[model samples]
Target: MNPIVLWFHKLGSPPYFDRFAARWAPWGHGLGLLLIAIGLYGALFRVPADYLQGDSFRILYIHVPSAWMSMAVFAAMAFYAAIALVWRIKLCEILAMACAPIGAAFTLITLATGSIWGKPTWGTWWDWDPRLTTELVLLFMYLGVMGLYHAIDDRRAAARAAGLLAIVGVVLLPVIRYSVVWWNSLHQGQTIRLFGESSMDASMMWPLAWTVLGTKFWFLGSLLVRARADNLRREAGKAWVAQAALPAVAADPRTEARP
Candidate 1:
């Protein structure tokens, strides 16, 4: 096997991944928190309000990044699911399952922050806007993936069904991306740009950039935490799990109680 592929294979091993997650989770969480704090300060104090929307638009600091992550996580989840289905990679299945709830949580956050931002600007808390409607469907898809995972008693079988669901649901991603452009919607179009002029000025844009990076790190930390816990559960009887599970974790009464 090629060296890089060999390293990646070793990385996917549950024991190695547990150790990796243990070491990296804290780093991801610490840096993520620091960046998020700085981003919040910049968003709240440094950035000027939109000349049109005033203070209400400030929620974009959380909303836009979260919205992006919701879709991005699902895309990632589906990719892993496809790998799990095609290659039968156990770690890919676990990672795909891990992504479902996190993506769902982000989707919910996006809806909430969007609603909060919408009330003052759109004159209502809820809308049937194409983007908003599609986003809600995305949340349901995440939930469906979770539901499918938990419905089966056999672990591998559950992963297979759930992975298939995730793969089929990938269509929602592009739909969600283009909904704003394809239809006349109340939600505003994209303002951030990579190469061209952005609709926002530096003061308003910089904080958003920081937050986008921070949330990605936070998501990494979150995924590692969830994946590690799930890995431990699935491998509870294995020797490596016995050796790797901390005394505090293994001794927890709830750990024994877990089905």
Candidate 2:
């Protein structure tokens, strides 16, 4: 077997991952917090507001990133589901399951922030804009996966069902992306763009992009911590779990007696 596969195989085991997360969690949290602080400062004070939108456009700092994350999480969940379906890997299913609530949380944040922004800019708190409608649908799909997980009694069965749902739900992504073009809506066109000319200036775009990156890091850290806890809970009865859970070289003779 390839070394990379061999390393992954070892890392896939519950104990290794648990230990890895423990070591990495603090650094992840620290980095995320630092980046978020800097990003927020730049967004709030350094960046200038749009001429037309005025102060109301400030909500984009939060709304846009959360919206981006909502879609990103779903896409990630779908990819994980595909991995679980094709390879029948338990780890992939567990990861996909773990991501459901997080994705749903981001979706909710996106909706709330968009609503808040809309109230000031569009004169209402809610609109049936293509992106907003599809995002709500994405949130529902995430809820469906979580509901399915709890509905099934067996862990593996629940993961498989949820994985199937996630894979099937990938259709929502394209719909959300095309919603603005497909229908007339209050939501404006894209502000920050990669290929085309973005309406946003440098100060606004950079901070927003930084905020997005910080959130992505925060999500990774959150997932690692959650996944670690999940694995520890699932493996609680195993001998290795007991050994790994305890501190090293305790000098208690009984600790060695457990295999």
Candidate 3:
């Protein structure tokens, strides 16, 4: 097997995954937070205020990253769901389900931040614009997946059911992405482009790049941590779990004899 494939195959083992997650989760989280802090500082202090929007535009550092993650995480969940369904990989199922709450959180941040930004810019807290409406629907889709997963008694079965919904709900992603262009929408059109020139100035764009990278790292950490916990729960009562817990038990002073 290819080295990459072999490594991935090893990750399917709960024990290997537990170790892998433990090793990397903190690194992902720490780096993510550091990058976000740098990004925010640059956004607030380094970049000049927008000619029209003024200081209020600084919120984009947070808003755009959250908005991007909202959709990106959902797309990742659906991809994992597809693989789990096709290959019956338990790790993929756990990963797909684990993505729900985190994705929902990003969606919520996007909505809230968008609302805050809009109030000053658009003079309204809410609107039924196509982009905004589709984004709202995206939140509901995430909630629905989470709700469906918990409603079932069997963990594996619940994951499968919810994974199916995730796959189906992916149709909303493209709609949300293109809604501004497809209709007369109050939401602003894209200003940043990965492939071509962005309308935003370089100074303003740098902070956004930092924040975007931060969110990706943060999501990776969150996913590994969540999936590791779920994997441990699903594998409870097994020999490996007992062995895994032994070290912690041995290290606890409370586990020593009462003198």
TM-score of each: 0.93, 0.92, 0.98
For residues 115-201, what per-residue lDDT tens digits would candidate 2 score against the true structure?
988887888988777888888999999999999988998888888888889999998998898788788877787667878889788
lDDT of 1 by residue, 7-38 (tens): 89998899999998888988888888989888
lDDT of each: 0.90, 0.84, 0.95
lDDT of 1 at 179: 90
Show model 2 residue runs off by greater than 4 Å.
248-259
**Model 1 regions more than 4 Å off:** 246-259
Where does the lowest 10-residue lDDT sum fall in candidate 2?
250-259
Model 3 pairs in collision: none
Q: 1-259, model 3: which lDDT tens digit per residue?
A: 9999999999999999999998999999999999999999999899999999999999999999999999999999999999999999999999999999999999999999999999999999999989889999999999999999999999989999999999999999999999989999999999989999999988789999999999999999999999999999999999999999988899998897658
Q: Write the number of the candidate with greater TM-score, choosing between 1 and 3.
A: 3
Clashes of each: 0, 0, 0
Sliding window of 10 residues with minimal summed lDDT for model 3: 250-259
Q: For candidate 1, which ten residues in a row score worst on lDDT? A: 250-259
